[model samples]
Target: MDFAIGGMAAVCAGFFTNPLEVIKTRMQLQGELQKKNKQNIRYKNILHAGYQIVRHDGVLALQKGIVPALWVQLIMNGCRLGFYDYGLSRGYCNDKYGNVVFYKSVIVSGCGGVVGHYLSNPFYLIKTQLQSESAKAIAVGHQHHHKGTWKALSHIYFKEGVSTLAVIACAYVE
Candidate 1:
């Protein structure tokens, strides 16, 4: 029940925020690895990003990685929230009434988030790549074009390396 509810909530939230995620990823991956040429940025700000994406790539551009994003969010948030609820129920981290203790909950939630994020790291990577990889966006000098989520993971693993995945997973938090 908890997993189901958590999954549903994650799906909703993922869909709602996917465009922001896409914009954020594009922002991060914009400006080449060299000294960032701020003058050459395609998407200036969040609003401008939204407008340009819709205008250039259509409305669906904002939802580029909708599949992988939703999957990652569903799995990550479900596991993290599930673990949190389990900890609270077991009185392991939260107060007796399941109210969160600030530090304890942070620790617990962070641990859960790390594990959950790790589990979904491949898809997360795919999501970032999907959002960032236009004809112009070259990630870390890699030029291989990816087809989809699994392909992106495979490209990162077989072509790139798993260390990349580690960085992505560890960077995320609750």
Candidate 2:
């Protein structure tokens, strides 16, 4: 039960972290030269940056990445907990008294992280592309290419297919 709760917590944590991640990625993708000239860029914190996004784009802007973010989180946490349970039940988490203490399962849990990410890479790649500034900019007036997740995925598959996935996997291997 504790592991189940922990998995749910992980899901929620992933959900909340995504908005800030969206902001951070956008900041990092901006021109370095332009960023270097901005005085406030160095000193501004997450709150300040979030405030700027809200100020310019309103409250709904914070939730731009929430859909894919939630999906990724749910899949990740579900696999993590499921695998942890499997490991524990399979004698991989035996304790001093042959009892499975929760901490003894950390190794299995960490492996679960890697497995979950790899299994879910396509989802995450789409998530990243959806949140990308270039895509967003192109989407401003181009409604045809700006379909929601499922449709956008079909577009990606039609245009790039598994090569897109292979590139992402290669990057991870590197």
Tell me the TM-score of each prediction against the true structure. Answer: 0.74, 0.68
Error of 2 at 160 (Å): 1.0
Instruction: Write candidate 2's Cα lDDT for 1-174 as tens digits.
Output: 534665578768977777777666555544343456632242155676567666665666666656666666766676778778878878888875778767768888777766666656666666666554333322221123334667766777788897876676556534
Q: Per-residue alpha-carbon lDDT of model 1 for 1-174, expressed as tens digits?
A: 566799789899999899899888776655454355433557677898778777776788888888899989888888788877777677778676777788886777677777787888778767777776554432223434668887778777886587877776766643
Using lDDT as the measure, the top candidate is 1
Q: What C-alpha RMSD separates each model from the true structure?
A: 3.9, 5.1
Candidate 2 residue runs with Cα over 4 Å from true position: 1-7, 31-48, 95-106, 133-145, 166-170
